[model samples]
Target: MVDRPIIFSAAMVRALLAGRKTQTRRLATSPLRRVEVGDRLYVRESMHLWSAGHDAEVTFAADDRSFQTGPNTGDIPDASLTAYFRMVDQSRAKGRRISRPSIHMPRWASRLTLIVEGVKVEPLQSITSRDAISEGIERAGGEWRCYDSSGTGCLGARESFCTLWSSLHEAPGQRWQDNPNVVALSFRVEHGNIDTLYPNLRSARA
Candidate 1:
């Protein structure tokens, strides 16, 4: 194998940072398994975001002059993280097994945010929450039957919507399996900010 010297450019550095992505890691702060019917259970998870990869354009700016923007702040991809959380929740409901509950945001996702390159996904009407849940379940390799919270066939309550191949998954140890019911959880999602860790990456061109 040849020892190839790594080289970088300013444009490369700027390009890397020009775009971003976000991720979140959530844990069950309380005993989530005890969630019961008639209880308004919502998946609660802390969110963090960061740039997806080594692009010269990405830069980490701190609200304070000091480095480190605490947690949940940075070049994180907010939209992607939200999408990921929704995906995980959908999967869990469908009886799909999950280990971790952290969100994963990749570079390609950021690239797709643009209008030209981005996809045109219609906002799912709230009238299909059950369908969204069922679809999410099916994608996670679980059998699902559409029904509303009122126990009626098909969806009765709709809040949000999703599309095909636009979902996220748990990354092992994210969700508890023994209990298998995660209605509420808490954790932080961290996006990898190459600019923050190795600032030199931000100066690739220089």
Candidate 2:
């Protein structure tokens, strides 16, 4: 599995989003839809802010997944791709369907698990769990306690890996709603699978 970075200028990101077929009108609290690089269109979340300064958000329809044409380095006007070693679900919107993106990958490449570390999260299975999210908490050296909800098809199933990130010693209250940082997790899946799952974090330079 090769690892690389996919960097997007603020402007190019908007052009990509503008090309998407789904109307970018709604700002519902949902995970940003996955957009394929070089294939699908994309728009940055920051571009949608009005006077109230809504949260930065972007969305791509599942249809764009098949259009992924790989990463870009020369400022391609079309949607560009970034090869990465990890992918994180930054759109922590609760109650949305968590389906796989439509990228052009083999069947074996579809199976992946994200190991988020260095934060606190609560398992979405707690009574306070939300319908849209399989929540988890990140705490103490990448350790996470996740809540597996019925939507995840892992509710009460110990084999499930659904979890949410939370703060240390904050108890199991609904405090995650106040977190401002984008949701990020550590990577430990198959080498090739890492970037596909979290291109943003994997491409980010330290």
Candidate 3:
């Protein structure tokens, strides 16, 4: 019944929002925070233009090309955002600087929940075509075995997946082909009255 926070790239976050992604893999580096069956993860999307907490409207200014009011900041528009504002505002008012990066987002701000169904530790290269598809790699056509002249499995499931992975994390060792071991987690979206699962509060304006 413990709640875990998982940070997802903006693209992955969108995929989850669209109900296209259901599985994810992570390095098994943190033994204390190891993921297990039945555990729930609150997805935190990477910082973007629309993540400004409690900031009712998008400042959408032309000069602010980076889309942040300042360093490490973005704005989000939602009614529930204000209630969260109060919680952090109290901290800020006492000189406790606000720092809510995507991964560090408060539990109350989470909009997506993933209930873990299974977990496995395996070599990263052991990922199969079926596993790649589960990891949200979409196929273009019937090119399951289509190979390039160089013998690379071009357009193949695992190939496409590796390409996608390299885009987000180029691997600390400088090459994705290094094939480090990872923990793969399969989860199901919990759909129902979320409010009953967690209470929502409206904070008073300061």
lDDT of 3 by residue, 22-57 (tens): 888786674413777877676654322332343321
Model 2: per-residue Cα lDDT over 101-143, one tens digit each: 3332212222222232222222333323221222222122333
List, residue by residue over 1-206, the lDDT tens digit for candidate 1. 11111111222122223331111111233232332222221111112233222211211121101122222545434433455444445444654422221122232122111111111122223223443433222221232323223332332212211221112223353322222222221112223332333333222110
What shift in Å separates residue 59 of candidate 3 from its native position after superposition? 11
Candidate 1 vs 3: which has more TM-score: 3
Candidate 2 runs further than 4 Å off: 1-61, 64-120, 127-206
Deviation from native of the Cα of residue 94 in model 2, angstroms: 42
Best by lDDT: 3
| Colliding residue pairs in candidate 3 | 51-75, 52-74, 52-75, 52-76
TM-score-based ranking: 3, 2, 1
Superposed by TM-score, candidate 1 places the C-alpha of residue 142 at a distance from the truth, in angstroms, of 12
lDDT (0 to 1) per candidate? 0.25, 0.25, 0.57
All models, RMSD in angstroms: 20.2, 18.6, 8.9
The better-scoring model by TM-score among 1 and 2 is 2
Reference-based TM-score of each model: 0.16, 0.17, 0.63
